[model samples]
Target: MNPPNSLNPALVALDSLPLVVSLAAPIGVAYSGGADSCALLLAAAERWPGQVRALHVHHGLQPAADDFVRVCESVCTGLTLPLQVLQVDARHGPGDSPEDAARRARYTALAAAARQLRLQAVLLGQHADDQVETLLLALSRGAGLPGLSAMAPRFERDGVTFYRPLLQTPAAALRDWLVRQQIAFVDDPSNSDERYTRNRIRARLLPALDSAFPRFRQTFARSARHAAQAQELLVEVAQEDLDRVGNPPAIQALQGLSAARQANVLRHWLLRAHQATPSTAQLAQLLGQIAACTTRGHQLHLKVGSGHITRAGAVLRYTPLGDKAG
Candidate 1:
């Protein structure tokens, strides 16, 4: 039999990930000193050798965060790979989710660090369980098609390309491999805190799912892919409609389309052009106002996701939260 960590299940899974980058280009791995990321860092370093670098984001939210950096530094030193540690504030504002704020901060810091280092792409360690959890959370929130589509394997954010290669692999397989190889990894204490919905799902729901469905990971992933395909078609239609309706979307041209198309195109416009998303209530209200505006004297002003969508003459305009008064 082959030695542990040599052509192991976890390593094989990582190898199967269809990455699109030149072999000569450098890559950065988001190392969190956890089992999944540690396994990924080891596999990537083995494959790319000198071309792989570890990028660890220190959110400074907990006292143990400093130990994570020390472990990452030690591992990188042993592998002869460069390690970059970035300090970021992951605090949340009023009515904001702590998880979401930390995620945004981490991504922004990672992108900035990757750009500064001239890395071609960054790799993440999100696995199959995480994907399934995301889908469940979306379902619980009555999310739209985009939310149902879950995480994409490859995505661009802040001009940096990121890839999730382990989405097909299970978390247990990675942990098992790490144990067999006598590798060390720290478990984040927050992961066990049941105060979070995700942790509760991981602890209580996953075991039940494993017992009943057995193949929930593969099946759930298949559904997410189908949703993603449907979302892509919707985006294409929205693009065509926006082209006809105009950038600011002339109210007259927008009213010509069906209510469904109006909603689709408008949602696409706000997200693509203004980086804003409307809540369901906000979109429904905006749609009604657009339908009622037959007279030249009719006015419209509504709040939508950190911005206000108001009628400026014959077209709809988005003014950011700060510029609303102007």
Candidate 2:
């Protein structure tokens, strides 16, 4: 069999990502010294000399974390790029996913660093294969439109804009290009730890998808975009529906809407108004209960949010789980 690390002319000529021009004057790149981030940092620095700075988040989760930072510093120094490293506590809760905790902490630290640097946005190296893996993970978890939407190329977090310029390019091509250029980078060992769901998908499923469908990443990304668009439309309709239904949501007003529309409106209200996200099963059950409420005495109670959703006279009210019944 051919080697896994071999490269060809097609890979060499693979498409490059377009940068966001509106990200203010000194562009910040989330450089982890990995092949992907290294390639992105080099390209951005080359395109915008003396205007690109590398921001590295140091999550002290492993023994090699320091090594990663050292490599990143060396690369940035060689490129004559300013490098800033922010150390963070990435410890997860007892029931929390380690990867998720690290990701959230990394973004929080990056946003804080961006504020210190007065940068409005930072570039990330997430690529097409990463997008496909995200889509697959969402599907695996039986997620809704938002989860299937995967990652956006640009998004706002804590007043900082996060841009992923490489979402349209494949990961293999990025790594191959870095190798061909003889640029130095460090491989994070955790990436190959198949215990993580994303890692397993990346190591096993991606190759299978490549063989079964040569252009899977492109099509998968297209599907994610469609899902994102559809979700935005749903959110729009839900907003309109909520305006008509009114806050505290009159039961009579909600009953006038279709079951799907009722769920949409409730989801919008709970999340946007109260910061609560109900599961698909819970939402479906709540919709059924809403349809069954025929009399004033017909009490409805649903365990959702951080609280219980209950019908109080003509309107549905959400009370925190530990609060006394009113």
Candidate 3:
């Protein structure tokens, strides 16, 4: 496959980097008909041609959702790229917000599409600005090192490697590229809605920060990079501890480490064992309760979805709590 030399200057620089070269498989770009994703699709088509296909997930949240899909199809057709459009039911569960439900459903559909198509990797158009916003949101939630680390360039989930090749590209640069190419795209109005925390950050907090500090985005991106490196080291240390202690002995293994190490180990163990990530608040409360309990026989449980952590003898075990007997 030819390299993407004709892409925007910023993206051209990213494509030359080692990370993109080392990706495990050919890239499948997720196209949403937004400027960011459209630029990525075009760049991928030029760079990887036969290796890139456009995948679109239609959540049907907006009235023009189908039209957006049509635009994506047209773009792909013009570029002679294969296109897959998936319709997902994103209705929220009781007490669950729409955004959360929609995102979960979207990823589920994308993963299914990837598996069925036998695709090894999926590319997203998440850019440097998005990473900065995510890092700030994580900090606002009092997230520890891992959360602050934000998105990685590549991550494996559900047997597919998700690649964010444009992580270092700025949103403005993508917009400029699209304009230069005379590419038409849809602007999702939901992005401007202030009700969502992410929207609020992008609309309010980020602008204020940008006005006061012109390089706020770059600063946050750098901070996230530093946090990612630190988290990597912490994860190595936590893995060593896990190897030494095996499993928590009556949750006592948690109390044995320094507070930072305890959090790291707990996060790592939960991720490895159950593939679950507890909220920052939930993790803090769970750790505190686990440490303070005096009665050896008292069972300490923290429930997430159908999963629960229970203290058994001297070990804390994660188990899927039984469903209601029907």
Candidate 4:
């Protein structure tokens, strides 16, 4: 389905939120009592009543987290919807991106909660501004097609489906809608801190986008969709390439393909077979090394992610750091 293409407050029609949430029934709304989520929750409850579940993940990263939970509880109680608050440890270690760590933790918590609660799908409140920030961040970091594509509207993980029905809606529309309805929502303090790249992008870059391109959120999102489509096609090609190379691909056979195809298939293999993803530079370097492998006696070893891409004779294998090469 094409994402809704406007951030104009009018786009948040009375029925729009309910319309989006109805598509994925028996869904758990990832509620945080923020404007975006509050609007979503209100609409879902009004539309489906007993069908909607409010799932709140308490990251415990901020002092205001407890307050957020209280707000979510109050809203859920008022709406007569069941609320489940899952507190999680979302600390980022040295050298780890806090955003990445928190995201991983959030998803983990969601999956675990979904399993425990036996929910079919989880809905998120991420909006068009988030999409723009993601795309811009991907550009800033020189990420590849996969990164540029950003978040998927719907994806399945750990036997549960995740839906982002508001991806096409802008944050402004959500806030305005809530204001008109006189619904109170808390602004996350951490979101204003520019120490994080996403926060900086949201605060500084978003306004600049508004001035330069009045509807840049939708435009940026369209570009992201294009990138996502392109990435899907590449993934298909990589899958086909993998089928030809056989499992634990033979080094000789892989070296026969072009550099780009080699990179594609290797990326597919690493992610699927080893649960590891590498940077573009790392993939290119690894491809160069594969090209340099001219003899059976030549050793094949390079660090890729938290593992080493090692050659066990003709077969390329991934061994986690410090694991036996077998």
Candidate 5:
């Protein structure tokens, strides 16, 4: 591997990051031993020196998991930075996808590690291409503003602040920089397997998009930013509406608002309060049921994500299906 050097232009390009002016250190880098993450680890170590730590999660889903950790050990040893490795079960649940399961496990592990280390923040290495891929995936899945907004540059999960410092950087730039610097990093074979939607998009859709729109990454990122801004406003409005409507959302008060506002507020209530998301059909049905509830005799019982939305007296209530009471 190339030796550590000055903060050159190449490094600076990888540095347009975090969307936050200041972050509390000692910061942790989520190191997966991939090109994108390796570039981030190197940059963070260079910039922060003693203030940096590497956090690697070993999802024992593949044979190379141990190899990845070994690479992380080598890199962290060379940088004189502490490395924390967390072994995680990334197996998907009955209704969950493998990618989602792995991602959830990875984030949980990262947050736990950061908390244990007393690190103020964790930096992720998802780049511009990954952002574009997320946007495309959302589009393909008919996702709303939340998904269309794609990945947030900064977010809080499990009470830990996470930053995607390389969100605006290009994938090619990271790999190219790694090549130039002779940085050693592993390539996850799953990334090339086209069975996954993201891998398929990366293999097929991205090249086509690039050919058609040379600056698709920047433009797509701009669109995502707009979506995020709009979603933020919607959230503000939803919070106001929810406060007016009550947490359980009184049926009479909900009926006072327009269908669009009702949809907005209800969606916000389910997602924010219950961590539940209803499908479009399910939400629409719930709205129809609400509209039909002109008498006390009318009932509301609809199945939502892993939960059931039911009428508890005059207000709506969501209970996990797992609860015997639900």
Candidate 6:
């Protein structure tokens, strides 16, 4: 983690946000040596000197991974911030993509580092442009409200808070700031690979949209904000209904709600019961079956990855499926 050459606008703007106070325990910044993440490290170190540490995960996919780690370590040394370099093998599973596998490995390394360092929060460099891309990807996949909401500024998982203070900043601004500071960063060649949807969105779709509509990023950001607000309200109402209905709702009680609300309630139930969210198609199929079933004892099984829903005896129960069964 290194401080900027001078107080940049991003730092000034971030400082205006409500400061999250943490004790002397170090704050982890997921430094990738990229412009965006390097900017985040700079801001975190500038704002909370001596309390910020940089953790860089080396995915070992690139030939220059060691060089990237060295750059991260050098930056941290310059700023007098502690650094942790983790090496991870991002091998894809049977049906998994390399990008997805790398992301999972990156987050796993970050979470483990946070626990080892006892950090309160891990700061990420996800900015407004990334948010727009995420929202667009979710929309392309016909995702529901929650998926359309994209990423949150702050969230807790595995006893550590993930913070995205730069969510309101654009990647261009961060890159410009880095250039102004004469900071050299690596540009991953994988970003140009069109095999990934995000790269296609970034290189082709977003640039074309920016040419046609200058404020496309802001528009998508605003849409995500509105969708997030609506999703929050829906979750509140669904939780209230869940409390009233007890553990498993009676078929009569479930059928009393409107189709949309029933889907919302079931979605919430599935999320809480399985500790993982269902894909858009899975949710739609589950809701479709729930609505189409007329007989009282009709059983509908909705499979969500490692979890499944079994509707038997007029009670919808979520159970771990296949090898996950306990």
Best by TM-score: 1
Model 2 ranges off by over 4 Å: 1-24, 322-326
- Model 4 stretches with alpha carbons more than 4 Å out: 1-25
304 in model 5: Cα distance from truth in Å?
1.6
lDDT value, residue 192 of candidate 6: 84
List model 5 lDDT by residue over 21-47, tens digit each: 244658888999999888888888777
Evaluated with lDDT, which candidate comes out highest?
Answer: 1
Clashing pairs in 6: none
Estimate TM-scores for all models: 0.94, 0.92, 0.84, 0.91, 0.93, 0.89
Number of clashes in every candidate structure? 0, 0, 3, 0, 0, 0
lDDT digits (tens) for residues 1-326 of candidate 2: 33554543222322343444554468788998888788888777766677887999999999999999989988888888899988999999999999899999999999988888887468888888889999999999999999999999779999998888777788878777667667788988998999999999999999999999999999999999999999999999999999999997999999999998999999999998888999988999899899889998999989996888999999999887778768
Clash pairs, candidate 5, are none
Runs in model 6 with CA error above 4 Å?
1-6, 276-304, 323-326
Ten-residue stretch with the least lDDT total in model 6: 1-10
The candidate 2 region of ten consecutive residues with least summed lDDT is 8-17
Model 1: residues >4 Å from true position, as ranges?
1-6, 324-326
Model 3 TM-score relative to the real fold: 0.84
Write down the lDDT that model 5 would get.
Answer: 0.88
Q: How much lDDT does each candidate structure score? A: 0.91, 0.86, 0.78, 0.83, 0.88, 0.81
Residue range 1-326, candidate 4, lDDT tens digits:
22353233423433454334444446688898888778777766665668888999999998899999898988888888999999899999999989989999999989888888777677788888888898999899888898899888878888888877777888977887676666678899988999989999988889988999998988888989999999999999999999988789888889889888999999999999889998877888888888888987888788999999877888888998878885
Clashes of 5: 0
Residue 203 local lDDT, model 1: 96
Candidate 4 collision pairs: none
- lDDT score, candidate 2, position 39: 80
Question: In model 3, how large is the Cα lDDT of residue 325?
Answer: 19
**Candidate 6 lDDT by residue in tens digits, 1-326:** 34665565457656855657577688888999988888888888878878988999999997878888888888888888899998898988898988889988998889998999999789888888899889989989888788899998778776778888777787888888888788777677777889889989999888898889988877888888899999999999989888765567656677777877777877788677667587767877877877767797677877876777777576777777654422
